[model samples]
Structure formats: structure tokens, C-alpha cells
Target: MNRFGTVVIGGGQAGLVMGYHLKRRGEDFVILEGHPRIGDSWRRRYDSLRLFSPPRYASLPGLPIPVDDCPTRDEMGDYLEQYAAHFELPVRAGVRVTRVSRDAEGFRVETDEGEYLADQVIVAGGSHAVPQRPAFASELDPAIRQLHSLEYRNPEQLADGTVLVVGAANSGTDIALEAVKTHRTLLAGRHPGQVPVDIDSGRGRMMLPIVMFVFRHVLTRRTPMGRKALAEREGHGVTLVRNKLADLDAAGVVATSRIESVRDGQPVTAEGDILPDVGTVVWCTGSGPDHSFLDLPVFEGGRVRHERGVATGEPGLMFLGLEFQFAVASGTIQGLDRDARYLLRQLRQNTVRSASRPVTVDRR
Candidate 1:
């Protein structure tokens, strides 16, 4: 089997950044990617999708954003390809990692292409791999076409009748807005807190400096709703209409409370209101971590236990690009860079320790 100093799983931003750092340190490592090409995940996103943050914050280590202002999704993809080429990162694409286990030697990575033995392993797949659909959704009638946000491309694929979009996050909101142009759309779930796509606009430019202070230093996700309301109104980009759900109801788009049950080809709301005539039900719930391939004792309480990106209780096992791994920004493209750098430092320390170990021979 081929052996490596380190093996990084998933070729996204986190993996690429780790590879760059490993190269700089003169470490022998390889990146394993499930996709056929680099940045295929970003390229497959909806055509209308763009980075939530500005281009200035979207760059990885040693590579600047394409222009300087705001780079589109396609531009981001191209930049990643360029980043990979510039570093000459050793990436084995189209190789799906099936399992990772520990033995006396170290990590044993089994993939579709072949097996690899690595002294260390880095799992950087992030959280979006597994789509989370509601369990009750399966009980719905087979006639009602149900799709997750991951599978949703455009409104054309939906049935010719009314469409119900559950969850009001970015994907849910964008999908609802897109579907409204064609089918009667009903947006369900709590209103989402939003920020302006361009925070440095006409009036926003003047308050730009204060915006950072409020979002970072003062306001937080854990703030009280009243305090959050102040920031939500002033800093939050959009306002939820007093009766946004009610508006959908008035527009012939049924506005129901949380889904309770589905029986006889119908969705029964919490109030026992049954909407039987709905054609499509798009579940934009979200996703969970798909770590089925991870075979280690590092995971604790359903999450990988790591101290500042270094896996605890297990030597030479680390995780990067996990949601809230250290901070709320840990999973973001910008945040992965910091985690990658920290992980690289830990890896270098490990290498030094291994080299300094005293060699002892076994005498039979």
C-alpha cells in the first residue's frame, strides 16, 4: 500500500489550505477528493448563489481573491482551481474514501481506488454532505413530490401546482422567491435573520465601521430577542413583514403552522388544518455531518472531540472545517484558513516529537 505522512480527506477549502501548509513545511501529504474535479461542490450550487461574505474575505492562504470586491461563485471555483495548480497540491480526485481506521502503524484509509497508510489523517469534509430531511416527510403521500434543497435546481422541476417550501433559511428564502415567479409558493418556518449582501452601500458606507463592532463585539447570536431586534432592524438587511406568512395565505398560498402529520396524500398542520391539494413539498431543513467513513474513537457526544482543531484522546487525528469547531465562523471558507493554519502547526509539532523519540530495539 502507498504510504503518506498525512492524508487530508475532502478537497474543499479546508483540505486545500491544509495541503498548502503541508507543502510549505516540506511534509509529505496527499489530498483525497470524492469529486472528479476541484471545487466541484461550489460549481454545483444554484446558478444564482453567491458568497455570503465579500470576496476580500473569501480568499485562502497565499492566494488573493480574483479582483478585490465581490467575486461570483464561478469566479470562486476558478480561483480554487488556480490555487490547486499554483501549489501543485497532490490531489487524488474521484477517490471516495470508504473507511479510516487505526492500527499499530497509524491510519489506514480505504478508498475506491486503493488503500493508503498515513501517519496522520485530517477529515475536512465540512457539514453539508448529508442533507437533513424531516422524518415525518416520508409518511406523506407518494403522489406529493418531495425534494430537499440539495436536489432542488429550479422551479421547472416542480409540479404544476402549488409549492410549499419549508424552512426560511437562505436556501429556503431563495427557493421561495424563485418559485414565486411561477408556482404559488408558501414559505413556512420562522423568519430568518439576514444581513445585507452589500453592507457598504450609500447609507451603509457611513455606518460600515460601526457595523463590525455591533456584529462582532456587541451583538451575538445568543443575545436576547429585544437586543437582537435592535441589531436585526438596524444591521440586519431585510425586515420580515408583520404577516409574511399571512401574506402568502392571502395570495392563495396556504400558510400553515409547523407540519404535524401527512395522511391520505395531504399535510396536516399543527392546527389540524389539512392541505390536501398541494403538489410539491420542498424540504429545505438543512444538513448534518456525514461521518460514516470515520472509524475512530475521537468522536464524542456525536461530535468529533478536538482541542483547537487537534483531535484529543487520539494522536495524529485531526478535524477541520467543522461547524462551530472553535468559533461560529469555523465552517466558513474564510474561517477554515485559520483552522488549517492551527492544524498545520500541530502537525509540525507531532513530526518533531516523532523524530526526537528514542529508538529501542526488541531483543528476542
Candidate 2:
């Protein structure tokens, strides 16, 4: 079996950042990516996707984004590939991790290619493992095209009719605005809120640093307000940034109640209004990490039991890129820098503690 000092179970921003820190410390590690390319995850996103943050906030630790303006999905993807190449980070693409379990020596990483033995493992694979959709989605009319936001590419993918976009969050609003250009669009569900100012405006740019500071430092797991925000974050979608409720209205997209069920081969909302003319239903509901492959007792109440991304019960196991892991920005690119540093420090401390312990010999 292949062996390394550490194995990172992703090649995205989080994993790459972890690899960067590990490399800085001259640690042996490998980043395993399921996709064939380093940044295919971003490349695979919907075409209209762009970074909500400006170039400064969108960059990784070592490399600045090549764009001065908000970057497109492809630009971000290419930049990630560039970052990996520039750093010469050890990455193994096209290696799908099937399971990760504890071994006598350390940890066993099972993948489609082969097995790997590592003294430590870092899961920076992100939270969106599976595309989430309601069970009733299967009950929709077979003739009506249905897709999760993850599968949505462009309006060209939709059929020739009105489109019903479920989940009135950022993705849903963005898709609705796009769909309105070609087809009649209906946006459902209530948005959490909107940013007080336009993020791209001059004043917003000036305020970006302050907002980011609050998100990164003030609103952290250590603060009471941050803990409250984390508790509420699970139910609330991120506040709208680029697109607002006014934009959706101005774009002629009809806003409706949340989708509760399906009736007569159509989508029915909470108010019992059935949308019969919705030729396409785009589910923009959020997704969660699929930790089913993890064979560890590190979960509590359906969530990973961790203290700021460090697995509490499991040694040599760490998680990165989890929403609200330490702060509201924990899942963002800029957040990885600090998270990686903290985790690595913890790892070093653990190693030192392990090494300093007195060796007990077994008497037979």
C-alpha cells in the first residue's frame, strides 16, 4: 500500500491550502481529488457563476486571483489549477475516496485506485458531497425536466416553458434572473436577507474589509455572537450578495411561497397553489457532506463532532471547509488560510505530546 505522512481527502481550495502549509513545513502529504483535474469542481459549476466577493477576498493564501473584477466560474477554476501548478503541490486527481477508517498504525484511506496508509488524514473535501433534492422530486411529471442546481448549467438546458426555481437563496435567485431572459420564471421560498449595500459598489468595496473582518474574527466560534450565528446558520441561507429581491422583481420573476409538495404532476406551494405550467423545476436546495464513508465515532446529532474543525474523539483526524467551522467565512477561500494554520499547529502539538510520552514495554 502507498504510504505518506499525511493524506488530504480533497484537492479543492481547502485541501490545496492544507497542502500548502504542509509543504511549507516540509511535511510529506498528498491531496486526493475525485475529479481528473485540480479545479474541475469549480469548472463544473453553472456557467453564470461568479465570485460574490471581489478579487482580493477571492484569492488563496499564496496566489492572487488573476482578475481585478469578480471572477467567472471558469476563471476561478483555471486559477485553482494555476495555484496547484505554481506551488507544485502533491495532488492525485481521479482518485475517488471510498472509505476512511482507523488502522493500528494510523489511518487507512481506501480509494478506487488503491489503498493508502497515512499517519494523519485531513478531510478538506467540502460539505457539498451529494446534490440535495426533496423526495417528492421523483414524483414530479416525467415530461417536466427536473434538475438540482448542481446539475444546472444554463438556460439552454431548460425546456421551452416557464421555469420554477425552488429555494429563493442566492443560487435560486441567480438562476431565476437568468431564466427570466428566455422563459417565464417563478422563484419560490423566502430569502434569508440581502446585503445592505451592493457588494460591487464603491462604498461596498471600502466596507468589504470591515465585513470580512467581522466574519473572520468577530463572528468566530470563540465569540458568543458567533456561536449564536453558527447555531442559526443551518436553517438560514447566506444573505444575498449580488442579487437581491428587487432584482428578482425587476427581472419579472414571480416570487411564491415555499414548495411543500407535488399534486397532479405539478409543484404545490405551502399556500396550496399548484404550478401546472412549470416545464422545468430547478431545485436550489443546499447539500451536505456525505460522511457515510467515514468509519469513525466523530459525529453528534447528525453533525461531525469537532472543536473548530479538529475531531474531538479521533486523533490524527481533522476536517476543513465545513460551514461555520470556526467562523461564518470558514467555507470560503480566504478562511482556509487561518483554519489550515490552526489545524497544523494542533497537529504539531499532538505529535510532540505523542513523542514525549514514556514508552511502556509489554512484559510477556
Question: How many clashing pairs per prediction, in order?
Answer: 0, 0
Clash pairs detected, candidate 1: none
**lDDT, each prediction:** 0.73, 0.87
Candidate 2 local lDDT, 1-364, one digit each (tens): 6877788999998999999999999987889999999899998889999988788988998789999898999999899899999999989899999999986656889999988877788999858868888889988999999988999999999997889999888899989999999999998887789988898899989999999999999999899999888888876677888887788888899989999899988999999988877899999998888787788899889888898888988888899999888998898886889999999997774441244334332111
Candidate 1 Cα lDDT to native? 0.73
Candidate 2: minimum summed lDDT over ten consecutive residues — where? Answer: 355-364
* Alpha-carbon runs more than 4 Å astray in model 1: 67-69, 196-256, 351-364
- 195 Cα displacement, candidate 2 (Å): 0.7
For each candidate, what TM-score against the reference? 0.83, 0.95
Candidate 1 lands at a TM-score of 0.83
Model 2, residue 151: C-alpha shift (Å): 0.6
Q: Weakest 10 consecutive residues, lDDT, candidate 1?
A: 234-243
Model 2: lDDT of residue 307: 89
